[model samples]
Target: MVSKEKLNRINELSKKSKEEGLNTAEKEEQHELRTEYLKVFRERFKKKLDSIEIVDDETGNNT
Candidate 1:
């Protein structure tokens, strides 16, 4: 999971971007933070999906 501080930074950067635009360094930092956030999100989502147990009651089978 992304840390709370990092999440807050992401939000701050987004708001700054929408209101006043970001400098080159800020844009790069935003990009890096967003990438890391997405990567972590996708990994956790995949794990949740992998843990799901599918069952077919009509066929009396578990898949």
Candidate 2:
């Protein structure tokens, strides 16, 4: 079984990964817009995801 300390570290890393992923995605979309590669699509997709309720499914609260 994972130790509590290790579990907490894993959870922290997971949260960081999610935030990093979102940042990278935003940058990529920005580049796509600059290059005229469906800027509207990129913006729309990001907008939809931004509107998502940031809740853990099981806990029904923020992660």
lDDT digits (tens) for residues 1-63 of candidate 2: 334664555455456667764366655544544344345557778999988777788988885
Please estimate how well model 1 matches the true structure, expressed as its whole-model Cα lDDT.
Answer: 0.98
- Candidate lDDT (C-alpha), each: 0.98, 0.58
Q: Write model 1 residue lDDT over 1-63, tens digit each, in one string.
A: 999999999999999999999999999999999999999999999999999989998997887
Show model 1 residue runs off by greater than 4 Å: none
Q: Which stretches of candidate 2 lie over 4 Å from their true place?
A: 1-37
Error of 2 at 57 (Å): 3.8
Pick the TM-score winner: 1
Candidate 2 displacement at residue 47 in angstroms = 0.2
